[model samples]
Target: MTLADTAAELRHLHDAPELLQVVNVWDVVSARAIAALPETRAIATASHSIAATFGYPDGEQIPVDLMLDMVGRIASAVDVPVSADLEAGYGDPGETVRRAIGLGIAGANLEDELKPLGEAVAAVEAAMAAADAEGVPLALNARTDAFLRGRDRPRATNIADAVERGRAYLEAGATCVFVPGNFGEDVIAELVAGIGDRRVSLIGLPDIPAPARLRELGVARLSYGPYTQRVMLGALQDLASDLYGGGVLPRDIRQLN
Candidate 1:
């Protein structure tokens, strides 16, 4: 599909009845694996995972050019729609959004990172304008770090802050509001209620309810983020350790050239 078509499909997935479950990928291999899944609808890139693959730490440590290139490669390798995790829009939200769209990405996540609400709002506005000029209707999932940063605050206050930032971002042209770190079913419900009609994306948490339950709670999207990558890497480590201990390698490993 063309970039516009894929973007439209991704945007529709956000508002679809079933929760959009994204198994975030960091590279071409992972992207293809996810794309090959019959249950996978779209592919989202994890910025943290990508940074690690490049030997950089998370928090926008990866250079914007390399990040864009990696995302482009993943998009090229898969037929499914690809959404990029463009952290803090790489300090230039508008240009970053434009480049993402230009690279055939269907959507992107832009985190606010505890910035002043107004500044984040402006960034969203600028991104929307850039996408409009490019004639690509990109799905921009504006992420608020309120819950992540407000662990010490009262629950009520944290939820309130997240909802306020979420609503403002949605009004500023965000396709969805991602509020990570508050995974309880009740808090998730509150976020859904607080956002009111805007799609809400949440990161997966251990104690959090299942995707089915989250869908029932009105969550529009769920993502594994860097956890998926971490799990895969951990498995790789275990495999290497076992091999070093003279354990037999799996048949798949033997087949590798």
Candidate 2:
């Protein structure tokens, strides 16, 4: 399907029965391979993986030009809707929306803790306005970083403030609100309850809960962040080490090739 068509389809998938299982793809090849899977319906990119692929850290190390190039390449290579993990939207809200839509990306993630809560919400609102101007429904997943740092930290100490910021993001035209880093089942349940019926999408960290359990908790989406890519790289390193030691390859090695 065309990118525009794919975006529309993804919007529809939000209402489907099963929770959206989003796999993070770092480049064109991985994006194509994952989208080729029968069960895969959409593609998401991990900022960390993307940075690592380019030999950089996750923080705004990569240039916007390079980042957008990677995004466009992935979008062109896959048939499913593509959502990018745009860290801090790369800047102000207007630029974020314009750049994302210009590249034909269906959605993006904007984080709150990267900036003051009020500025983050304002940025999201500006992005939403830009998306509207483009005539494409951009699914802005507003991320709250408070939970990632732990409740003992100053950020998580104020749950009410986080919830209020989340609500503000939703009001600014975000299709989903993502709170990463918190893992307690009860904590997650409370977040889901607080956000209640806002058409807001909640994404759970991979290792926290089983997919089935997360689904039961009313999570609309789930992602592994850089975990899968890290596993793949780690396995590759081990395989290389074993080969250097003159170890025989596993019987399934041929299948991998």
Candidate 3:
């Protein structure tokens, strides 16, 4: 399928109740590999991985154009739905919507924690308006960082604020809500129960609570951010060291050669 076709399919799938597994791809090669998987239906880009590929940190170092280009390349290589981690919506919700639509992306991850909660809500509202104007249903996954960073901090203050921010984000037109960070079963259950019947999407790491468990807890989608890339990098380093240290290359090397 073409990228546009995949986008359409993804938009349709967003409404379904079944869990969608979105694997994060760093480059064209990894994107292609994930696309080849029979069970894979959609792809997500990890900002950290993308920045690392360009020798930059994940702290908004790379320009928006560069990130969009990388996303376009990955989208072109795969026939599956491609959703990008548009960190903070690359500034300016309207412009971000336009750029993503131009790149043939079905959806994007938007966060409501860039600034004060009020500002974040406004940003999401602007993004939704932009997407509506573009005539493309951009699945905006509103992310909250509370559970990921503040759970152990001033527990009461953080949890309360997170729930409030998440509610505001939903009201601002977020199709899904993602609470990242290490969350315990009770927390996860509370979030799932709290969001209750709102078109919210929850995403968690594979290493955390099991994917199946998250699904049972009402998570709409599961994504393994940069875990796969990290694993791959480790394997490559080990293999290269073995080859240079008098170890024979595996049979797979012959196939590539």
Residue-level lDDT for 53 in candidate 1: 97
lDDT of 1 by residue, 1-257 (tens): 57888888999999888999999999998898889879999989999999999999999988999999999999999898898999999889999999988888989999998899889899999998998898878888899999888888899998999999999988888889999893687888889999964379989989778989888888888898999998998999998999899998776653211
Would you list the C-alpha lDDT of every candidate in the order shown?
0.89, 0.75, 0.75
Query: Best-fitting candidate, measured by TM-score?
Result: 1
Say which candidate scores most in lDDT: 1
* Model 2 lDDT per residue over 1-257, tens place: 55556566766665555678888889887787788889998888888898899998887788877887898888877778888888887766578668877887998877776467778888888888888788777877788776654466664464555577777888887876777774567666767777643333555454467777767777667766787698889999999999999987887653211
lDDT of 3 by residue, 1-257 (tens): 54445555775665566677788888998998888889988889988799889988885678888988999898777777888888787667678767877788878887765378888888888888877787776777788777655656776565566677778887887777777766567766766666643344555554457767766767677777777789889999998999899999776543211
State every prediction's TM-score relative to the real structure.
0.96, 0.90, 0.89
**Residue 87 miss distance in model 3 (angstroms):** 0.4
Q: Is candidate 1 or candidate 3 better by TM-score?
A: 1
Model 1 TM-score relative to the real fold: 0.96
Cα RMSD for candidates in order? 1.6, 2.4, 2.5
